[model samples]
Target: MTPFERSRGSWTFPFPGLSLARSPPDDRPTFWTRALGETPEVYGERLREQDDATWRAIDPTRSKLGAALCKGLRELPVPPRGRVLYLGGATGTTASHVADLVGRRGGVYVVEKSPRPFQRLLDVARRWPNLFPILGDAREPRTYLSWVPPVDALYLDISQPEQAEIATDHARLFLRSGGGLVLALKVPSLRKGGGRGPLSPAEEASRSLSRSFDLGPSVSLEPFHRGHFVITGHYRGTGREA
Candidate 1:
């Protein structure tokens, strides 16, 4: 879908620390530059020179969400200004971009299990007022379920072998009816055996997700990154049971 056709919901809250304004309508080149994994130096220079608020430096090696956002922006549902729950918000790289997409009016509750990543995520959250970083495991939804209300979307990028199951569990609790979900499945994490196999690892991962949700169209990022797939699904009109 074209950017103009994309849906824009009401703004909930505009955080003070997030000073970066959206890029100008004519700045297609700038959008591509930020979409691709521009070097930190380049990203910083560009941000400073252009005074652009929408652009941020993302570590491609660490974040499949970043890669997916770059390519799958069009597919992501426009979230309501209510709330968003992001699982596996490692270091807040992709979470920050999501915060931008959700805008200040919306609330983004990011959950991360690792203390190391949680620390960094906290730092990123401090800069973006709308983001609330929760240090907890995605596998255990009950731990953080009370902290977040029902949300418009659930974004999952955890690399666990049972990543699909984990995401589904959280979706059941946090996602509102007709809410959206985006999952970045790591094929190797779900693979059972080593060496070149007849059944592609990605196919297996896809099957696992298909069992729980109506797997929507997917974007294969193998050209940009190896063994990675970005899958988006919605709870609405999906007959699958929780």
Candidate 2:
């Protein structure tokens, strides 16, 4: 199935919180334009000229995609022209940067369930050629599994009480054997009680993933954002083991 391919014309989806506008002027300031230390005008100019088929934004307030991009560039073993599956791709912000990094030869499959954010994601995909956006629930991998086969890396940024489980399910089904995974788990979302918990949210997530994969190094994005943890790991075995 592979979902729909990227197109240049306008398209619509059922995203709840997305507000689509005509592509902003080259001078309009975007959060990412600032975060990456590029003037809005400069960033906008570059975006306008970029011919890549896939592009998206990296909203800092909503997810740690921006922070993880900054950190992953320094730490993660992201290879050039690699494939990436981005879960919880709200509004396509972070997905865009990833597309840029991977370039035209590579690909990014962005799955977002929220109708609001999915709307914006649709809009961004119009210009970026390498980005493939799927408007569906990430929890139900079977729904989109046929369309999304194994990839070199799986990046998740879903904020839900069962985030760890959701991420693991995707990895088990779609991640290539020995592929890497980047999970941005939101602690508060997983809180069982109002404030009376013994094990922290992070601890629970780590333990859950360890059941299947060999959990690797993890880093808290507190220095860049609050209450976010980026955990990275590899699938437990070769294709034969699974």
Candidate 3:
């Protein structure tokens, strides 16, 4: 299942955060949130809408990005034809949908440290040409820099205690001017070690990101994932402070 169709004409921000989508006529209204097409699809169930078109249901429970969209996230920082650097690619679940969202013009460079996950990501990439899977660590952005172009956005879902630092490092290396960044802060990662410095995990990440990007509102993936926060922003580059 792949690209084609957004929520509506001219309203492309993040694609399909429609007021109508929140409450549809069906009992399972939230099941199918489409950018185009009418037939409702199941979560994780991939289906072909046409000979040349395919759509995969983005399960809110399975993906934080999906949860954010369902939770009234007004803007999608990643634009059409925009390149994205997906940290912690994680078997290509969310990465596949993102690849679909970007279409053929744009590409997503996914970095996964583990071999098991990278192998699965490779399988997903075969179906979609826009997805490029890299067997590398997210902490070392430079290791995979040569494989990626100047990306339009950087999305991090790594569980490292220093995940924010890891994401920021990549942004500084690869993100272009005005690029979007979405960092999923896993609170438990920091909580286990009693944390360091004075600031809380979320505040520290926000402060660090603020240095290079003009951040937007953040949302908690409550009920879906406990103590998970998704933060989005636009990179202004390192030389020119935001």
On lDDT, the leading prediction is 3
TM-score of each: 0.72, 0.69, 0.82
List ranges where model 3 is wrong by over 4 Å.
1-43, 46-52, 193-198, 238-242
User: How much does each candidate deviate from the true structure in C-alpha RMSD?
Assistant: 7.3, 11.3, 5.3
Please give the lDDT score at residue 188 for candidate 1. 78
lDDT of 1 by residue, 1-242 (tens): 33322122232223222222334565321121122122223213243322242244343444565465445444565363547789888887777667766766877899999999888787777677778999998878899867887787788887777777776777678787677778887777877433256656666666656665666778766555787888887764332232
Q: What TM-score does model 1 achieve against the real structure?
A: 0.72
Give the winner by lDDT: 1 or 3: 3
lDDT measured at residue 195 in model 1 versus the true structure, 0 to 100: 22
lDDT of each: 0.63, 0.62, 0.70
Q: Write the per-residue lDDT of candidate 3 for residues 1-242, one digit (tens) a residue.
A: 11332334233465331222222233232323222323323234534343334445567788888777666666779987778889998888777777767767878898889998788787777766788989988867778767888888888898777776776678778887788888888888867644677988778778877888899999988878789878888887762122
lDDT of 2 at 65: 51
TM-score of 3: 0.82
TM-score of 2: 0.69
In terms of TM-score, the best-performing candidate is: 3
